[model samples]
Target: MIARIAMLFVAAAPLALAACATPAGEYPSLAQREIERVGMVMTPPQTTPAPPPNPTEPVLSQARELVESVRTAHAAFLASESAVRSRVAAARGATAGSDAWALAEVALAGLSTQRSRAMVALADLDRLFIAASTSGESTETIGEARSEAADMVAAEDAVLSELSAQLAS
Candidate 1:
C-alpha cells in the first residue's frame, strides 16, 4: 500500500507544477495602458521651411565664368589645330633643329599654351570646389565646370601628343 501511494504522488507532481506555470502567450505587456488618462496629445517636432532659391549667387556665376573661359580657350585651340597639324606633317622627315623642325616646335608650343589656358581655368574651378566644400556650400556647379574643362584639356593634350610624335618621327 505504501508503494501504491508513492506511485500516485509521483504521477500527480507534474500536474501540480503545470497548474502554477503561466502560458507563454498570456504574459503581461510593458506598453503604456492609459496614456489618454493624462489628457495630452503627442505632437511631432516642427521644422523650419527652406529658403527661396536665388539665381544670382556669386559662386554659381563664378563657375559659369570659369567654364566659359575654358570653352573660349578650347575654341582658340581648335582654330589653330589645322595649322599645327600641317606644320607637324611638314617636319616629319626633317632633322632635329632644322628649320622645319623649329617651326613645328613653335606650333606645338602655341598649342600647348592654349591647353595651359584651359588648364588654368580648371585649376581655378578646383579651388572653387574646395572652398565650397569646406564652407558647407553646394559644389555641383563647380564640379560640373571642372569636368568640362578637364575634358577639353584632355582632348587638347591628345592632339598635342600626336603632333609631337609626328614631328619627332
Candidate 2:
C-alpha cells in the first residue's frame, strides 16, 4: 500500500507542474496579459463629437404665430364687446321690469363671463411666452410678443371695467 501511494504522488507531481507552466508559443505570459487588460480598463474612453447648434428662424416664426393668434383673439373680443354695448345702449330707456331690460341684463352677464374667459386666455399666453423665453428660445421675438400681449391685456381690463360700470348704472 505504501509503494502504491509513492508511485501515485510521483505521477501527479509532473502533471501539476505542467499545469502551472505557460506553454512555449507566441502568446504573452499570464502577468503580461493581466497588465494589458488592466491598462485597457484604466484608460479613458474616446468621446464622440458634438452636434451643431440649432437654427433660430423656426423658433422666431413660431413666436410670431403665437403673437398673431393673440392679436386675432383680442380683436374678436373687442368686436363682441362693442356689439354687447350697442345692445345695452338700445335697451337703456326700457323699464326695469320690461323684456328689453331683462334681455340687456342677460347680455351684460354674458359679456362679464366672456371677459373673464378672455383674461384667462391672455394669462395662459403670457405663461407660454415666459416658458419659451426661459427655455433658451429666441428672446428678441418673445420679448416683443410679451410687450404686445401686456398692452392688449391692459386695454381689455380697462374696457371690461368701463362695461361693468355701465351695467351698474
Candidate 3:
C-alpha cells in the first residue's frame, strides 16, 4: 500500500507541472489616454460673372447704311410711280390683251423692277436683325431700321395693288 501511494504522487506531480508550463494569451489595457480636438475649415463658393455689353456704333452704322439704301430705292420707285399710274389710267377701259393693256402691263413691270431694289435692302436688314437676335446681341436699332424699310415697301405694294385693280377693271 505504501509503494502504490508513492507511484500516484509521482504521476500527479508531472501533470501539475505540465499545466503550469503552458503560456496564456495577451490582454488589452483599460486606462484612459489624452485626446486631440480638430477644427474644420470652409471656403466660399465661386460664381461666374455676366457678360459685358457689346458696342453699338458698328451696328448703328450698318443700320444707317441699310436704311439709306432703302431710301434710294424708294425714291427711284416713286419717280416711276406717276408714269405707271398714267398708263394704268389710259388702259382703264381697254379690252383684255389689247395694245393699251399690254402697255400698262409693261409699265407695271418697270415699276415692280424699281421696287425690287428697295426689297433687296429690306432683305439685308432682315438678315442683320436675325443674326443679332440669334447671337444674343441687341436688336433694337436693327428692328427700327427694318421697320422703316418695311413701311416703304408696304407703300409700294399698295400702289401696285391700286394700279393692278385699275387695269383689271
Candidate 4:
C-alpha cells in the first residue's frame, strides 16, 4: 500500500503544477500593458453608411398611386351601384343595405376619403415636381405637365364625390 501511494503522488505533482499558471501571470506587467495598449487603440465605429432608399423609377409617386387606385375603385363601385339598381328595378321592394351593398358603401366611403386626401397630396407632389423640373427645363414643358396633373386630379375628385353620394343613398 505505501509503494502504491508514492507512485500516485509522483504522477499527480507534475499535472498540478502545469495547471497552476494562467496566461496573465506568465508576464504580468507585459500582459497588463498589452491589454491597456489595445484598449487605447480601440474605438467605436464612427461612420455608418446609409441604406439605399426605395427605387422610384417605375412606380408613380405614392400619392398618385393612391389617388389612381381610389379612382379605379370608385368606377367599379359605380358599376356595382348601377347593377344593384337594375336588379331592384326587376324585383319590387328590393331591400337596401344587402351584403353586397354594404361592401360597396364601405369601399366607396373609405376610398373616397382616401382619394381626396391622396389627391391633395398628389397636388403637392406635382407642385414640387414642377418646381424641380423648372430649375432645369423650359416653362412650356412645366406648364403642360402641370395641366395634365390638374386634369387627372379633377377627374379623381369628380368620380369620388359621385360614388360617395351613391354610398350615402
**lDDT of each structure?**
0.90, 0.70, 0.89, 0.55
- Ranked by lDDT, top first: 1, 3, 2, 4
Specify the highest-TM-score model's number: 1
Better of 2 and 4 by lDDT: 2
Q: What is the C-alpha lDDT profile of model 1 across 1-169, one tens digit per residue? A: 9999999999999999999998778988877777655656677899898996763388889999999999999999999999999998889899999999999999999989999999999999998899899988888878888898899999999999889888878
Clashing pairs in 3: none
Q: Distance from true position, residue 96, model 3, in Å? A: 2.1
Candidate 1 Cα lDDT to native: 0.90
Query: Per-residue lDDT tens digits of candidate 2, residues 76-113?
Result: 77777877787678677676767777777777777666
Q: How many residue pairs clash in each candidate?
A: 0, 0, 0, 0
In candidate 1, residue 143 scores what lDDT? Answer: 86
The reply for model 3, stretches above 4 Å from the true place, is 1-56
TM-scores vs. true structure, each candidate: 0.66, 0.54, 0.65, 0.34
RMSD values, in order shown: 11.0, 11.2, 19.7, 11.6
Task: Report model 4's TM-score to 2 decimal places.
Answer: 0.34
Q: Residues 1-169, candidate 4, lDDT per residue (tens digit)?
A: 9999999999999999999867875564643565477557777689988996643332235435544554554455445455444433343332456765565655555545545654564566566566546655334543444455566556756766665555455
Error of 3 at 72 (Å): 0.6
